[model samples]
Target: MITFILRRLATGVAMLVTISITAFVLLNLGATDTARRLVGQTASAEIVARKAAELGLDRPLGERFFEWITAALTGDLGRSWQSGQSVVDAIATRLPVTLSLTIGAVIVSAALAIALGALAAGRRGWTDRVVQVLSVIGGAIPGFLIALILVLVFAISLRWFPATGYVRPEDSLGGWLATIALPVIALSIGAIGSVAQQVRGSMIDALRHDYVRTLRARGLPHHRVVYRHVLRNAAGPALSTLGLQFIVMFGGAVIVEQVFSLPGIGQSAVAATVVGDVPFVMGIVIVTAILVVIVNLAVDLLQGWLNPKVRLS
Candidate 1:
């Protein structure tokens, strides 16, 4: 298990490196002159050139990439052109909000997906049919639309919670939760559907396996057979799917954050892009990529643990 984990971690690091290079190249290619943007429209050409030179933007692409990578490795994500704040500090300040939203949404979505999936799999009649319909509806709705509807119903009409903005959980746990409740629901909508579908499918497949048949023939009770044996066996594939869903949600959070006006990494990234803050944009990309890689590696380790036969092979 340790060996497998180490291998997966190595692979994840390599993947992150590749992702960093790709993001760096793409952002540089698409970006306008960050120095010019920083100095503003009123700045003269000579002033702009001087500013660019001062920022080392006048250096070769290879040198610039090296500097960026070095700074990133040392946890210096560079300064934001707009706010003139350290990118690291800006991200650190906002990280908690995004993390809270993402974690809450994932937990809710995962629990709901597992329960609904298990019910649908075990019942396989009216319960299953209803869940399938609902899942389809959820899958069809975009997250932004869901956020809008949630805000309208829960925040505007019902007035149950704040429609926008975020509160630190530590400041006022109740208020913080209330403020983000709608956004979490919106973010988890599609994830619930996708995860439920995967879980239901995997559970059904597990039930059909020879081991489950053998357990049933051995006079195991129906509930135990389904919940203990079947669900556990089915979890391997479902977990992999869940990891992929996490990746999807991470990206989707950007749009949802905007709709909800949450101060998260996603919101920062969007703002940076709109104003051409190259360093901040690149930092977001790198952080997101690293997270995805780590999650994927964790999934691989989980799969190995769940199915020891693979490790032996």
Candidate 2:
């Protein structure tokens, strides 16, 4: 297990390095003038040239990429060409918001998935049929649509929470949770659908295995057989699917953040890319890549732990 984990860590590092190179190649090799576009078209030619020089855009691509990667490793993600704010600091400021939204969505999705999935797996008749139908419909609808509907029903029609705006937890726990609640629900809807389907399928398969009957014949309590045996068997694939849902939610959070006027890494990335803020854009890209790689690694470790027969090394 330790060996497998070390290998995964190495793989994650390699993936991050590749992603950094790809992002840099896109930035410096693209036709856009990074400095001028970031500074604005109205800036004088002299100002553009000076800005480019100051930003090290005047250097060769190889040199610039090296410097950029070095600084990134050292926790200096460069200054935003527009705001002059450190890219790392800016992202750090927004990281909590994004994390909170994603975490909330994960919790909600996981709970819904486990419950609906187990129910559907455990029975036949209308309950199973209803869960299957709902899963299909929910999966067919995109997350942004869910966000719109939620805002309309819960925020606009009922006014249960603010339509827009975010609050820091440090200020008011209730306010902060209330602000993020709708966005979390919006992000989780599609995820719950996908995960529930996966769980239902996996659970059904696990329940049918010969060992399940053997356990049942041994007088094991139904709940014990389901929880101790069935869930552990089903969880490996469900966990992997859950990790993928996390990635999807990150993308969805970009639009949802904008819709709700919440400051988050996704929104920051969009703004940076729109303005050709190369450093900030690259910073966001690197961070996102790292996050994905770490998630995959974590999933592998978790699955391995769940089943002793599963071997990675």
Candidate 3:
């Protein structure tokens, strides 16, 4: 298990390094003159050139990347070129909002997926058809549209939740949950559909397996045979799908944050990218990549726990 964990961590580190370098190169290589943007467009050419030089846009890419990575390793991501705020500090402030939405969505989606998927698999009639239809509808709709509908219905019409903004869980727990509820539901629809489909398929296959039959023949109760044996076996694939959904939600969160005015890493990334805040954008990339790595590692650990053979492999 230790070896497996070490190997995954090493892979994650390599991935983070690769992503950081790529983001830096791409941001710098773009034609959108970061210096000119930093200065007013009406600024003289000479002034723009001087600004570029000051910002090290004149430096070789390799040299700049080396300096940036070294500083990053030492926990200095540099201040935003636009706002002059420490990149790390800016991200730290907003990370919790994104995490709350994403983690909440994941938890909701998983619970819904298990119940819907198991029902579809076990019942296998009109109930199965209904679940399949709902899954299809859920998967077909875009998340931003879902967010809009939720805001319109729950926030505007019913006034059950706030239409925009966020509240810290520490500040007011009820306010926090109410603020995040719509966003979480909007984010979860597609994930629940995808994961539930995977679960239903995996469960059906597991139910048909020889071991399931043997357990049943050995006088095991139907619920025990299904829940303890079949569901556990089916969960491995569903978990992988759910992990992928978690990553997808980050992208969706960008649009959702804009619609709902939630301050999060997604919103920060958008703001930074618009002004070509290279250091801040790079910080967002690194932090998001690190999160993806951590989630992937968690999924791997869960899979290993569920099936010991995964650790051996």
Candidate 4:
């Protein structure tokens, strides 16, 4: 198990390095000059050149990439070209809101998926059909559309919660939760469908195995047979799929944040992109890549723990 974990961690680090390189190259490939975009259009050519030089953009591409990576490792993510503020500070300020929303969405989605999936698998009749229909509807609708509808119904008409913006949890936990409730629900809807589908499929497949049949023939209670034997065996693949779904949810939250006017990393990334704030954009990309690598590693470890056969091998 230790050896497997170490190998997977090494691979994850390599993958993150590749992601960083790709993000850096793509961000710098655009026509807009970062210095000019930051300094303003009316600035003289000489001034722009001097600013670019000061920022080390005038150096060779290899040197610039090396500098960026070195600075990142040392905890200096560079200054935002637009605001002249440290990119790290900006990210720190916005991290709480994004984390709050992401965590809430994941919790809601995971609980609902597991419950609905197990229920559908055990029932396997009209209840299963109903769940399937709901899952399809959930998968078909876009998150932004769901957010809009939720705002119209719950915020505008019902006036139950604020329609936009975020409040720090420290100020008022209730208000913070209320403001994010709609957005989290919107983000979770699609995730629930995907996770439930995977869980149900895995459960059904596990139930058909010879070991499950033997347990049933041995006069085990139906609940114990389904939950203890079948579901336990099925959990390995479901958990792996859940981790991948979480990564997808994080990426999709960007659009959901924009539509809902939530102040999150997604909104910051979009703002940076529009204004060509290279450092800020790259910072977000690097953070996202790191998160993906870490999540994948964690999932691999979890799979090994859940399935001893994998660990032993």
Candidate 5:
């Protein structure tokens, strides 16, 4: 297990390095006159040169990357060109806001999907048909559209959840939950559909296996036979898909944050990119890549643990 973790860590590092390099290259390639752009199109030559020196844009690519990596390793993500704040600090401040939405969405999506999927697989009448039809429709709808509908209904009409802005959990747990509930639902509605479909397919396949028949023949209760025997076997794939969906949720949060007027890494990232804030953009990219890699690694390790055959191979 230690070896496995070490290996995964190495892979994660390599992936991070690649991401950083790509971001750095793209940034440099587009911003050839970095200092000129930083100041303004009308800035004098001396001012441009001075800003260039301050930014170290004149340095060789290798040295710049080394310094950038060194700073990143120390969590000093440089200053945002746009806001003039420490990029790392900016992202850190917003991280929890985005995390709250993403984590809440994950919980809701997984629970809703698993219940619907399992029921659809186990039952053969209206319950099955309804789950199937809803999954299709839900998957077809964009998350932003879903979010708007939710805002219109829950926030504007019913006035159950806050229309915009995030409430700090420390201030009021109830308010925070209510504030986040709609966004979470909006973020997860599509995920619920996709995951449910995967689960339904996997469960149906698992039910046909000889082990399921053996469990049923032994007179195990219907729920146990389906949930314990079938669901467990099916979960490996479903969980893998869920991991990918978590990453998708992170990306989708950017657009959703805009619609809801929530201050988060997603919102910050967009502003940074729009203004050519290389340091901030690079910071966001590296953080996001690390998260994606870590989640995928966890899924791999989990699958190995759940299935001995996977570990063996």
Candidate 6:
């Protein structure tokens, strides 16, 4: 187990390094005279040159990356070129909002998917057909479209949830939940469909195995056999699906945030990119990559726990 964990950590580190390098290169490649942008178009050529040199834009790409990465290791992600705000501090301020939405979405997705999947697999009639059809419709709808519909029904029309903005749990727990409810629902719909399908398939397969028959023959209750035994066996694939969906949720949050006007890292990211705030944008990339690594690592550990066979691989 120790070796497995160590190996996973090493792989995560390598992945982070590769992702950072790729993001850095892509951002730099299309960069258009950052110094000029900083000093303004009205600035003289010499002023632009001075600004470039001052900001180390004149330095080689490799040297700049080394300095940035070294500082990042110690938690210095640099300042936003536009706002002069510490990148780490800026992200810290808004990170909770995004985390609230995405994490809430994941939890809701997992719970609903497992229930729907188990029902569909065990019942295997109208219940199964209904779940299958709903899954397809859910998967077909885009998160942004879902967000729009949710806002219209739950926020604007029904007035159940807030239409826009975020409320920290620190401010008001009820407000926080109310604010995030719609966004979480929007982001979770597609994930629920995908994960439910995986869970249904895995559960069906597990139920057909000889072990299931043996458990039944032992006079175990139907619900107990299905929930405790079959469900556990089927969880591996559903977990993997959930893990992948978590990553995909981050991408979808950008559009959902826009639709709902939520104040999250997704909104901040869009603003940063629009103005070409490279330092801030790079900070977002690295932070997001770290999150992805952490989530994938957690999923791997969970999978290993659920199925010891996974640890061997």
Q: What lDDT does the true structure give each of the candidates?
A: 0.83, 0.87, 0.92, 0.84, 0.87, 0.91
Candidate with top TM-score is 3
Q: Between candidates 3 and 5, name the one with more favorable lDDT.
A: 3
Q: Clash pairs of candidate 5? A: none
Model 4, 49-148: lDDT tens digits are 9878877677777778898999999999999988899999999888777767777888899899988888899899999998889999998998889988
TM-score, per-candidate, Cα-based: 0.94, 0.95, 0.97, 0.94, 0.95, 0.96
> Clashing residue pairs, candidate 3?
none
Per-prediction count of colliding residue pairs?
0, 0, 0, 0, 0, 0
Per-residue lDDT of model 6, residues 90-182, tens digit only: 999988878888999999999999999999999999999999999999999999999999999989999998899888889999998898999
Alpha-carbon runs more than 4 Å astray in model 6 = 40-44
Tell me the tens digit of each residue's lDDT in model 5 across 1-313: 6666677789988988888898899987655476676788898988988887787787888898899889889879899987799887898899888889998999999999999999999997999999999999998899999999999998999988889988889999998898888889989998999999999999999898998889888999999998877898898989988999999999999989888988888888877776578898998898899888889888878987777666555
Between which residue pairs do clashes occur in model 2?
none
Output the number of the lDDT-best candidate: 3
Off by over 4 Å in 5: none
Candidate 1: pairs in clash: none
- Give the CA lDDT, 0 to 100, for residue 266 in model 5: 83
Please give the distance, in angstroms, between residue 253's alpha carbon in candidate 6 and its true position after superposition. Answer: 1.2
State in Å the error of residue 229, model 1.
0.8
True-structure Cα RMSD, model 2: 1.6
lDDT of 2 by residue, 27-123 (tens): 7764337777867789998888888888777888998888888988889988987789999899999988998999899899999998898888877
By lDDT, is 2 or 4 better? 2
